[model samples]
Target: MNLQDLQWGLMMMVVGMGTVFALLALLMVVLMGIGRLDRKRPHLPPPPAHEAAPAEATPTVHIVADGLDEDQVAAITVAVMTHAEHRRRLAAPETRAHAPGSQLFASRWLAVGRGRESSPFPRERR
Candidate 1:
Protein backbone atom coordinates (compact mmCIF):
# COMPACT_ATOMS: atom_id res chain seq x y z
CA MET A 1 0.00 0.00 0.00
CA ASN A 2 1.05 3.62 -0.48
CA LEU A 3 2.51 5.64 2.48
CA GLN A 4 -0.50 8.00 2.38
CA ASP A 5 -2.92 5.05 2.55
CA LEU A 6 -0.99 3.61 5.56
CA GLN A 7 -0.98 6.99 7.28
CA TRP A 8 -4.74 7.38 6.77
CA GLY A 9 -5.33 3.85 8.18
CA LEU A 10 -3.21 4.67 11.27
CA MET A 11 -5.10 7.92 11.80
CA MET A 12 -8.43 6.14 11.52
CA MET A 13 -7.26 3.47 14.00
CA VAL A 14 -6.12 6.14 16.47
CA VAL A 15 -9.42 8.02 16.18
CA GLY A 16 -11.47 4.82 16.71
CA MET A 17 -9.40 3.76 19.75
CA GLY A 18 -9.47 7.31 21.20
CA THR A 19 -13.24 7.52 20.78
CA VAL A 20 -13.78 4.21 22.66
CA PHE A 21 -11.36 5.28 25.42
CA ALA A 22 -13.02 8.68 25.82
CA LEU A 23 -16.51 7.13 26.01
CA LEU A 24 -15.37 4.61 28.70
CA ALA A 25 -13.73 7.41 30.72
CA LEU A 26 -16.86 9.53 30.48
CA LEU A 27 -19.01 6.55 31.65
CA MET A 28 -16.72 6.11 34.67
CA VAL A 29 -17.03 9.78 35.57
CA VAL A 30 -20.85 9.74 35.22
CA LEU A 31 -21.06 6.62 37.46
CA MET A 32 -18.87 8.31 40.08
CA GLY A 33 -21.08 11.42 39.99
CA ILE A 34 -24.19 9.28 40.41
CA GLY A 35 -22.61 7.55 43.42
CA ARG A 36 -21.74 10.92 44.95
CA LEU A 37 -25.27 12.22 44.46
CA ASP A 38 -26.73 9.03 45.99
CA ARG A 39 -24.53 9.51 49.06
CA LYS A 40 -25.62 13.16 49.39
CA ARG A 41 -29.36 12.33 49.02
CA PRO A 42 -31.28 12.43 52.34
CA HIS A 43 -32.36 9.05 53.77
CA LEU A 44 -35.46 8.40 55.86
CA PRO A 45 -34.82 7.92 59.57
CA PRO A 46 -35.10 4.32 60.92
CA PRO A 47 -38.56 3.39 62.13
CA PRO A 48 -39.08 3.78 65.89
CA ALA A 49 -38.98 0.52 67.85
CA HIS A 50 -42.34 -0.55 69.32
CA GLU A 51 -42.46 -1.84 72.86
CA ALA A 52 -43.06 -5.60 73.20
CA ALA A 53 -46.51 -6.73 74.34
CA PRO A 54 -46.90 -7.90 77.95
CA ALA A 55 -46.47 -11.64 78.62
CA GLU A 56 -50.14 -11.85 79.76
CA ALA A 57 -51.21 -10.58 76.34
CA THR A 58 -49.61 -13.58 74.54
CA PRO A 59 -51.10 -17.09 74.37
CA THR A 60 -49.08 -20.03 75.77
CA VAL A 61 -48.77 -23.68 74.62
CA HIS A 62 -48.59 -26.57 77.13
CA ILE A 63 -47.34 -30.17 76.56
CA VAL A 64 -48.65 -33.05 78.66
CA ALA A 65 -45.94 -35.48 79.93
CA ASP A 66 -48.27 -38.01 81.58
CA GLY A 67 -48.16 -40.69 78.81
CA LEU A 68 -44.47 -40.61 77.87
CA ASP A 69 -41.98 -42.56 80.05
CA GLU A 70 -38.54 -41.08 80.86
CA ASP A 71 -36.69 -43.36 78.42
CA GLN A 72 -39.10 -42.65 75.51
CA VAL A 73 -38.99 -38.92 76.25
CA ALA A 74 -35.19 -38.98 76.26
CA ALA A 75 -35.08 -40.92 72.98
CA ILE A 76 -37.52 -38.49 71.34
CA THR A 77 -35.49 -35.51 72.57
CA VAL A 78 -32.24 -36.99 71.20
CA ALA A 79 -33.84 -37.76 67.83
CA VAL A 80 -35.25 -34.21 67.61
CA MET A 81 -31.87 -32.63 68.48
CA THR A 82 -30.05 -34.83 65.96
CA HIS A 83 -32.58 -33.98 63.23
CA ALA A 84 -32.25 -30.25 63.97
CA GLU A 85 -28.42 -30.43 63.79
CA HIS A 86 -28.59 -32.32 60.47
CA ARG A 87 -31.01 -29.77 59.03
CA ARG A 88 -28.81 -26.88 60.18
CA ARG A 89 -25.76 -28.43 58.51
CA LEU A 90 -27.67 -29.00 55.26
CA ALA A 91 -29.02 -25.43 55.21
CA ALA A 92 -25.65 -23.80 55.83
CA PRO A 93 -23.80 -22.28 52.83
CA GLU A 94 -21.01 -24.41 51.35
CA THR A 95 -17.58 -22.99 52.29
CA ARG A 96 -14.14 -23.49 50.75
CA ALA A 97 -13.17 -25.64 53.72
CA HIS A 98 -15.79 -28.25 52.81
CA ALA A 99 -15.43 -27.98 49.00
CA PRO A 100 -15.72 -31.24 47.07
CA GLY A 101 -12.32 -32.77 46.07
CA SER A 102 -10.61 -30.44 48.59
CA GLN A 103 -9.83 -33.47 50.75
CA LEU A 104 -7.30 -34.69 48.13
CA PHE A 105 -4.92 -31.88 49.13
CA ALA A 106 -3.71 -31.36 52.69
CA SER A 107 -4.25 -27.60 52.35
CA ARG A 108 -6.06 -25.18 50.00
CA TRP A 109 -2.69 -23.59 49.10
CA LEU A 110 -1.35 -26.93 47.82
CA ALA A 111 -4.26 -27.21 45.35
CA VAL A 112 -3.08 -24.33 43.12
CA GLY A 113 -0.04 -24.19 40.79
CA ARG A 114 1.00 -24.70 37.18
CA GLY A 115 4.28 -26.59 37.93
CA ARG A 116 5.82 -28.98 40.44
CA GLU A 117 5.34 -27.97 44.08
CA SER A 118 8.13 -25.87 45.64
CA SER A 119 10.03 -26.92 48.71
CA PRO A 120 11.59 -24.88 51.48
CA PHE A 121 14.79 -27.01 51.51
CA PRO A 122 17.54 -26.70 48.87
CA ARG A 123 17.51 -29.46 46.20
CA GLU A 124 20.44 -31.86 45.93
CA ARG A 125 22.55 -31.46 42.74
CA ARG A 126 22.25 -34.31 40.25
Candidate 2:
Protein backbone atom coordinates (compact mmCIF):
# COMPACT_ATOMS: atom_id res chain seq x y z
CA MET A 1 0.00 0.00 0.00
CA ASN A 2 1.02 3.69 -0.37
CA LEU A 3 2.28 5.85 2.61
CA GLN A 4 -1.10 7.65 2.81
CA ASP A 5 -3.01 4.34 2.97
CA LEU A 6 -0.54 2.98 5.54
CA GLN A 7 -0.93 6.19 7.59
CA TRP A 8 -4.74 5.85 7.56
CA GLY A 9 -4.55 2.17 8.61
CA LEU A 10 -2.19 3.02 11.50
CA MET A 11 -4.52 5.78 12.68
CA MET A 12 -7.49 3.40 12.57
CA MET A 13 -5.57 0.77 14.57
CA VAL A 14 -4.56 3.36 17.22
CA VAL A 15 -8.19 4.57 17.54
CA GLY A 16 -9.51 0.98 17.92
CA MET A 17 -6.87 0.19 20.62
CA GLY A 18 -7.74 3.44 22.39
CA THR A 19 -11.46 2.53 22.44
CA VAL A 20 -10.70 -0.91 23.93
CA PHE A 21 -8.44 0.62 26.58
CA ALA A 22 -11.15 3.17 27.54
CA LEU A 23 -13.77 0.36 27.96
CA LEU A 24 -11.32 -1.63 30.15
CA ALA A 25 -10.65 1.42 32.30
CA LEU A 26 -14.40 2.06 32.70
CA LEU A 27 -15.05 -1.58 33.73
CA MET A 28 -12.20 -1.43 36.28
CA VAL A 29 -13.72 1.72 37.83
CA VAL A 30 -17.19 0.09 38.04
CA LEU A 31 -15.73 -3.03 39.71
CA MET A 32 -13.79 -0.85 42.21
CA GLY A 33 -17.01 1.04 43.10
CA ILE A 34 -18.92 -2.27 43.67
CA GLY A 35 -16.10 -3.62 45.92
CA ARG A 36 -16.12 -0.43 47.97
CA LEU A 37 -19.94 -0.71 48.45
CA ASP A 38 -19.69 -4.36 49.62
CA ARG A 39 -16.84 -3.47 52.03
CA LYS A 40 -18.90 -0.61 53.57
CA ARG A 41 -19.86 -1.41 57.23
CA PRO A 42 -22.68 0.42 59.08
CA HIS A 43 -21.59 1.50 62.57
CA LEU A 44 -24.44 1.10 65.08
CA PRO A 45 -24.74 0.58 68.88
CA PRO A 46 -26.47 -2.56 70.27
CA PRO A 47 -30.05 -2.51 71.65
CA PRO A 48 -30.36 -1.22 75.25
CA ALA A 49 -31.03 -3.59 78.21
CA HIS A 50 -33.00 -2.86 81.40
CA GLU A 51 -30.54 -1.50 83.97
CA ALA A 52 -31.71 -1.18 87.64
CA ALA A 53 -30.29 1.10 90.34
CA PRO A 54 -28.43 -0.53 93.25
CA ALA A 55 -30.31 -0.88 96.56
CA GLU A 56 -29.56 1.62 99.34
CA ALA A 57 -29.87 1.28 103.20
CA THR A 58 -31.84 4.16 104.77
CA PRO A 59 -32.37 4.73 108.53
CA THR A 60 -35.53 3.16 110.05
CA VAL A 61 -37.81 5.67 111.80
CA HIS A 62 -40.49 5.00 114.48
CA ILE A 63 -42.72 7.99 115.23
CA VAL A 64 -45.39 7.93 118.00
CA ALA A 65 -48.09 10.67 117.89
CA ASP A 66 -49.12 11.82 121.43
CA GLY A 67 -52.53 13.15 122.78
CA LEU A 68 -54.80 11.19 120.33
CA ASP A 69 -57.77 9.08 121.46
CA GLU A 70 -60.67 7.03 119.90
CA ASP A 71 -63.12 10.02 120.06
CA GLN A 72 -60.53 12.36 118.48
CA VAL A 73 -59.74 9.78 115.78
CA ALA A 74 -63.48 9.29 115.02
CA ALA A 75 -64.08 13.05 114.83
CA ILE A 76 -61.01 13.58 112.63
CA THR A 77 -62.02 10.71 110.33
CA VAL A 78 -65.62 12.00 110.06
CA ALA A 79 -64.42 15.57 109.29
CA VAL A 80 -61.90 14.37 106.72
CA MET A 81 -64.42 11.98 105.10
CA THR A 82 -67.09 14.71 104.98
CA HIS A 83 -64.60 17.21 103.51
CA ALA A 84 -63.44 14.63 100.90
CA GLU A 85 -67.08 13.89 99.95
CA HIS A 86 -67.78 17.64 99.65
CA ARG A 87 -64.73 18.09 97.42
CA ARG A 88 -65.76 15.09 95.28
CA ARG A 89 -69.26 16.56 94.87
CA LEU A 90 -67.82 19.99 94.01
CA ALA A 91 -65.26 18.54 91.56
CA ALA A 92 -68.11 17.45 89.35
CA PRO A 93 -71.63 19.06 89.31
CA GLU A 94 -73.59 18.56 92.55
CA THR A 95 -76.35 15.92 92.19
CA ARG A 96 -79.53 15.75 94.30
CA ALA A 97 -81.30 12.66 95.66
CA HIS A 98 -84.12 12.20 93.11
CA ALA A 99 -87.27 12.72 95.23
CA PRO A 100 -89.82 14.31 92.85
CA GLY A 101 -92.58 14.97 95.46
CA SER A 102 -90.22 15.93 98.32
CA GLN A 103 -90.91 19.26 100.19
CA LEU A 104 -87.22 20.35 99.85
CA PHE A 105 -87.37 19.88 96.03
CA ALA A 106 -90.76 21.67 95.80
CA SER A 107 -89.69 24.71 97.92
CA ARG A 108 -86.74 25.73 95.66
CA TRP A 109 -88.58 26.55 92.38
CA LEU A 110 -91.68 28.06 94.13
CA ALA A 111 -90.28 31.60 93.66
CA VAL A 112 -89.23 30.95 89.99
CA GLY A 113 -92.77 29.61 89.30
CA ARG A 114 -93.88 26.65 87.09
CA GLY A 115 -91.71 27.91 84.20
CA ARG A 116 -88.70 26.10 85.83
CA GLU A 117 -90.71 22.96 86.71
CA SER A 118 -89.30 21.01 83.74
CA SER A 119 -85.66 21.97 84.65
CA PRO A 120 -83.15 19.43 86.10
CA PHE A 121 -80.57 21.96 87.39
CA PRO A 122 -78.87 20.99 90.69
CA ARG A 123 -80.27 22.70 93.82
CA GLU A 124 -78.23 25.75 95.01
CA ARG A 125 -76.57 24.12 98.10
CA ARG A 126 -75.52 26.19 101.10
Candidate 3:
Protein backbone atom coordinates (compact mmCIF):
# COMPACT_ATOMS: atom_id res chain seq x y z
CA MET A 1 0.00 0.00 0.00
CA ASN A 2 1.11 3.60 -0.54
CA LEU A 3 2.46 5.62 2.44
CA GLN A 4 -0.55 7.95 2.34
CA ASP A 5 -2.95 4.96 2.50
CA LEU A 6 -0.95 3.40 5.38
CA GLN A 7 -1.00 6.76 7.20
CA TRP A 8 -4.78 7.01 6.73
CA GLY A 9 -5.26 3.44 8.08
CA LEU A 10 -3.18 4.24 11.19
CA MET A 11 -5.10 7.50 11.73
CA MET A 12 -8.44 5.67 11.49
CA MET A 13 -7.24 2.96 13.93
CA VAL A 14 -6.11 5.59 16.43
CA VAL A 15 -9.40 7.49 16.15
CA GLY A 16 -11.49 4.33 16.59
CA MET A 17 -9.49 3.14 19.61
CA GLY A 18 -9.51 6.64 21.17
CA THR A 19 -13.30 6.88 20.77
CA VAL A 20 -13.80 3.55 22.51
CA PHE A 21 -11.44 4.53 25.34
CA ALA A 22 -13.15 7.91 25.75
CA LEU A 23 -16.60 6.28 25.86
CA LEU A 24 -15.45 3.81 28.51
CA ALA A 25 -13.96 6.66 30.57
CA LEU A 26 -17.18 8.68 30.28
CA LEU A 27 -19.25 5.63 31.36
CA MET A 28 -16.95 5.18 34.41
CA VAL A 29 -17.36 8.85 35.35
CA VAL A 30 -21.15 8.64 35.01
CA LEU A 31 -21.28 5.49 37.18
CA MET A 32 -19.14 7.14 39.86
CA GLY A 33 -21.41 10.22 39.87
CA ILE A 34 -24.48 7.96 40.15
CA GLY A 35 -22.88 6.11 43.10
CA ARG A 36 -22.16 9.41 44.86
CA LEU A 37 -25.72 10.60 44.29
CA ASP A 38 -27.14 7.26 45.53
CA ARG A 39 -25.08 7.49 48.74
CA LYS A 40 -26.34 11.03 49.33
CA ARG A 41 -30.01 9.96 48.96
CA PRO A 42 -30.55 6.24 49.44
CA HIS A 43 -33.74 4.81 47.85
CA LEU A 44 -34.58 2.32 50.65
CA PRO A 45 -36.74 3.71 53.49
CA PRO A 46 -35.28 3.41 57.04
CA PRO A 47 -36.68 0.55 59.21
CA PRO A 48 -39.46 1.54 61.63
CA ALA A 49 -38.05 2.42 65.09
CA HIS A 50 -41.07 1.04 67.04
CA GLU A 51 -41.25 -2.52 65.60
CA ALA A 52 -38.75 -5.27 66.53
CA ALA A 53 -37.35 -7.43 63.70
CA PRO A 54 -38.35 -11.11 63.64
CA ALA A 55 -35.67 -13.65 64.68
CA GLU A 56 -34.11 -15.75 61.91
CA ALA A 57 -34.25 -19.54 62.32
CA THR A 58 -31.13 -21.59 61.55
CA PRO A 59 -31.92 -24.67 59.44
CA THR A 60 -30.70 -28.13 60.49
CA VAL A 61 -30.42 -31.41 58.60
CA HIS A 62 -31.80 -34.63 60.19
CA ILE A 63 -30.66 -37.90 58.53
CA VAL A 64 -32.95 -40.88 59.22
CA ALA A 65 -31.63 -44.33 58.28
CA ASP A 66 -34.55 -46.37 59.65
CA GLY A 67 -33.19 -49.94 59.68
CA LEU A 68 -29.51 -49.74 58.62
CA ASP A 69 -27.04 -51.21 61.16
CA GLU A 70 -23.90 -49.33 62.33
CA ASP A 71 -21.72 -51.64 60.22
CA GLN A 72 -23.72 -50.82 57.09
CA VAL A 73 -23.48 -47.09 57.80
CA ALA A 74 -19.72 -47.36 58.33
CA ALA A 75 -19.33 -49.31 55.08
CA ILE A 76 -21.30 -46.65 53.14
CA THR A 77 -19.18 -43.86 54.67
CA VAL A 78 -15.94 -45.64 53.73
CA ALA A 79 -17.14 -46.19 50.15
CA VAL A 80 -18.07 -42.49 49.78
CA MET A 81 -14.69 -41.32 51.21
CA THR A 82 -12.75 -43.68 48.93
CA HIS A 83 -14.67 -42.54 45.85
CA ALA A 84 -14.12 -38.86 46.78
CA GLU A 85 -10.37 -39.41 47.26
CA HIS A 86 -10.09 -41.23 43.91
CA ARG A 87 -11.92 -38.37 42.16
CA ARG A 88 -9.69 -35.73 43.86
CA ARG A 89 -6.55 -37.57 42.76
CA LEU A 90 -7.78 -37.90 39.17
CA ALA A 91 -8.68 -34.18 39.05
CA ALA A 92 -5.22 -33.10 40.28
CA PRO A 93 -2.34 -35.48 39.58
CA GLU A 94 0.68 -35.17 41.95
CA THR A 95 3.65 -33.25 40.58
CA ARG A 96 6.96 -35.17 40.46
CA ALA A 97 9.94 -33.97 42.54
CA HIS A 98 12.33 -31.54 40.84
CA ALA A 99 15.74 -32.88 39.73
CA PRO A 100 18.63 -32.69 42.26
CA GLY A 101 20.29 -29.20 42.50
CA SER A 102 17.60 -27.71 40.23
CA GLN A 103 15.02 -26.79 42.90
CA LEU A 104 13.20 -24.15 40.77
CA PHE A 105 13.15 -26.09 37.49
CA ALA A 106 13.07 -29.72 36.44
CA SER A 107 15.53 -29.71 33.51
CA ARG A 108 18.87 -28.37 32.27
CA TRP A 109 17.20 -27.45 28.94
CA LEU A 110 15.41 -24.55 30.76
CA ALA A 111 12.03 -26.15 30.09
CA VAL A 112 9.18 -25.59 32.66
CA GLY A 113 7.41 -28.88 31.99
CA ARG A 114 6.57 -29.64 35.65
CA GLY A 115 5.07 -26.20 36.32
CA ARG A 116 3.02 -26.36 33.10
CA GLU A 117 1.70 -29.83 34.02
CA SER A 118 0.14 -28.52 37.27
CA SER A 119 -1.18 -25.27 35.75
CA PRO A 120 -4.99 -24.78 35.46
CA PHE A 121 -4.73 -24.55 31.67
CA PRO A 122 -5.09 -27.79 29.73
CA ARG A 123 -2.02 -28.98 27.80
CA GLU A 124 -2.15 -29.90 24.10
CA ARG A 125 -0.53 -33.16 22.92
CA ARG A 126 2.60 -32.62 20.79
Candidate 4:
Protein backbone atom coordinates (compact mmCIF):
# COMPACT_ATOMS: atom_id res chain seq x y z
CA MET A 1 0.00 0.00 0.00
CA ASN A 2 1.84 3.16 1.26
CA LEU A 3 5.63 3.50 1.57
CA GLN A 4 5.39 3.76 5.38
CA ASP A 5 3.30 0.53 5.59
CA LEU A 6 5.70 -1.21 3.25
CA GLN A 7 8.66 -0.02 5.35
CA TRP A 8 7.05 -1.22 8.57
CA GLY A 9 6.21 -4.61 7.03
CA LEU A 10 9.75 -4.96 5.70
CA MET A 11 11.24 -4.02 9.07
CA MET A 12 9.08 -6.56 10.85
CA MET A 13 9.97 -9.20 8.27
CA VAL A 14 13.65 -8.47 8.67
CA VAL A 15 13.42 -8.75 12.45
CA GLY A 16 11.52 -12.03 12.16
CA MET A 17 14.02 -13.42 9.69
CA GLY A 18 16.95 -12.31 11.85
CA THR A 19 15.44 -13.92 14.93
CA VAL A 20 14.79 -17.20 13.05
CA PHE A 21 18.33 -17.16 11.59
CA ALA A 22 19.88 -16.46 15.00
CA LEU A 23 17.98 -19.36 16.57
CA LEU A 24 18.99 -21.66 13.72
CA ALA A 25 22.63 -20.62 13.99
CA LEU A 26 22.60 -21.19 17.73
CA LEU A 27 21.08 -24.62 17.17
CA MET A 28 23.73 -25.45 14.59
CA VAL A 29 26.52 -24.38 16.92
CA VAL A 30 25.07 -26.51 19.70
CA LEU A 31 24.81 -29.54 17.40
CA MET A 32 28.39 -29.06 16.20
CA GLY A 33 29.61 -28.92 19.80
CA ILE A 34 27.63 -32.05 20.61
CA GLY A 35 29.08 -33.78 17.55
CA ARG A 36 32.60 -32.88 18.67
CA LEU A 37 31.82 -34.23 22.12
CA ASP A 38 30.48 -37.45 20.64
CA ARG A 39 33.61 -37.82 18.53
CA LYS A 40 35.91 -37.06 21.46
CA ARG A 41 34.16 -39.57 23.71
CA PRO A 42 32.22 -42.20 21.87
CA HIS A 43 29.72 -44.04 24.07
CA LEU A 44 30.69 -47.34 22.53
CA PRO A 45 32.85 -48.75 19.73
CA PRO A 46 31.11 -49.88 16.53
CA PRO A 47 31.61 -53.65 16.27
CA PRO A 48 30.26 -54.79 19.61
CA ALA A 49 28.48 -51.95 21.40
CA HIS A 50 27.68 -51.76 25.11
CA GLU A 51 24.32 -53.42 25.44
CA ALA A 52 22.54 -56.23 27.24
CA ALA A 53 23.91 -59.64 26.30
CA PRO A 54 21.93 -61.09 23.47
CA ALA A 55 20.84 -64.69 23.27
CA GLU A 56 22.93 -65.27 20.13
CA ALA A 57 26.17 -63.76 18.83
CA THR A 58 26.82 -62.30 15.43
CA PRO A 59 28.26 -64.80 12.94
CA THR A 60 31.28 -63.89 10.87
CA VAL A 61 30.68 -64.62 7.19
CA HIS A 62 33.73 -65.57 5.14
CA ILE A 63 34.07 -64.73 1.46
CA VAL A 64 37.31 -66.54 0.75
CA ALA A 65 36.06 -69.65 -1.04
CA ASP A 66 36.81 -71.52 -4.26
CA GLY A 67 34.41 -70.14 -6.84
CA LEU A 68 33.76 -70.66 -10.51
CA ASP A 69 34.45 -67.73 -12.82
CA GLU A 70 36.79 -64.88 -11.94
CA ASP A 71 34.07 -62.47 -13.02
CA GLN A 72 31.65 -64.13 -10.60
CA VAL A 73 34.08 -63.72 -7.72
CA ALA A 74 34.59 -60.06 -8.55
CA ALA A 75 30.86 -59.48 -8.79
CA ILE A 76 30.26 -61.29 -5.51
CA THR A 77 32.94 -59.24 -3.76
CA VAL A 78 31.36 -56.05 -5.04
CA ALA A 79 27.92 -57.19 -3.94
CA VAL A 80 29.13 -58.14 -0.48
CA MET A 81 30.83 -54.77 -0.05
CA THR A 82 27.65 -52.95 -1.04
CA HIS A 83 25.56 -55.13 1.26
CA ALA A 84 27.86 -54.52 4.22
CA GLU A 85 27.80 -50.76 3.74
CA HIS A 86 24.02 -50.72 3.48
CA ARG A 87 23.67 -52.87 6.59
CA ARG A 88 26.04 -50.66 8.59
CA ARG A 89 24.12 -47.53 7.64
CA LEU A 90 20.80 -49.11 8.54
CA ALA A 91 22.00 -49.89 12.08
CA ALA A 92 23.17 -47.14 14.45
CA PRO A 93 25.93 -48.15 16.91
CA GLU A 94 24.94 -46.54 20.27
CA THR A 95 21.16 -46.82 20.12
CA ARG A 96 21.06 -50.15 18.27
CA ALA A 97 24.07 -51.78 19.94
CA HIS A 98 25.96 -52.30 16.63
CA ALA A 99 26.01 -51.60 12.93
CA PRO A 100 26.84 -54.32 10.41
CA GLY A 101 26.95 -51.78 7.58
CA SER A 102 30.26 -50.35 8.75
CA GLN A 103 31.81 -53.81 8.58
CA LEU A 104 30.19 -54.21 5.17
CA PHE A 105 32.04 -51.07 4.04
CA ALA A 106 35.31 -52.54 5.35
CA SER A 107 34.55 -55.84 3.66
CA ARG A 108 33.76 -54.06 0.43
CA TRP A 109 37.04 -52.19 0.56
CA LEU A 110 38.83 -55.44 1.32
CA ALA A 111 37.08 -57.16 -1.57
CA VAL A 112 38.18 -54.34 -3.86
CA GLY A 113 41.78 -54.81 -2.71
CA ARG A 114 41.84 -51.61 -0.67
CA GLY A 115 42.23 -53.49 2.61
CA ARG A 116 45.10 -55.16 4.50
CA GLU A 117 44.42 -58.58 2.95
CA SER A 118 43.74 -57.97 -0.71
CA SER A 119 43.97 -59.86 -3.98
CA PRO A 120 47.02 -59.34 -6.17
CA PHE A 121 46.55 -56.95 -9.03
CA PRO A 122 46.90 -58.23 -12.56
CA ARG A 123 49.51 -55.59 -13.41
CA GLU A 124 51.18 -52.62 -11.74
CA ARG A 125 49.57 -49.23 -12.17
CA ARG A 126 51.19 -46.76 -14.52
Instruction: Report residue 100 deviation for candidate 1 (angstroms).
Output: 43
* Ten contiguous residues minimizing lDDT sum, candidate 3: 91-100
Model 2 spans > 4 angstroms off: 42-126
Q: What C-alpha lDDT does candidate 1 achieve relative to the native structure?
A: 0.75
Local distance difference test, candidate 3: 0.75
In the range 1-126, model 4's lDDT, one tens digit per residue, is: 999999999999999999999999999999999988878554675696667556666755455557446667888889988987887787635436536545543555465665334545466689
lDDT of candidate 3 over 24-49, digit per residue (tens): 99999999999888786546877767
Q: List the lowest-lDDT window of 10 residues for candidate 4.
A: 92-101
Q: What root-mean-square deviation over C-alphas does model 1 reach?
A: 18.3
Decoy 4 TM-score against native: 0.32
TM-score of each: 0.32, 0.34, 0.32, 0.32
As a TM-score, model 2 comes out at 0.34
What C-alpha lDDT do the candidate models reach, one value each?
A: 0.75, 0.75, 0.75, 0.74
Give the alpha carbon lDDT tens digit for every residue of 1-126 in model 1: 999999999999999999999999999999999989888657789898777778646754444497776677889999988987887677644323566655655655655432235544555899
**Candidate 4 local Cα displacement, residue 83, angstroms:** 38
- Runs in model 4 deviating more than 4 A are 41-126
Error of 2 at 112 (Å): 99
List of clashing residue pairs for candidate 1: none
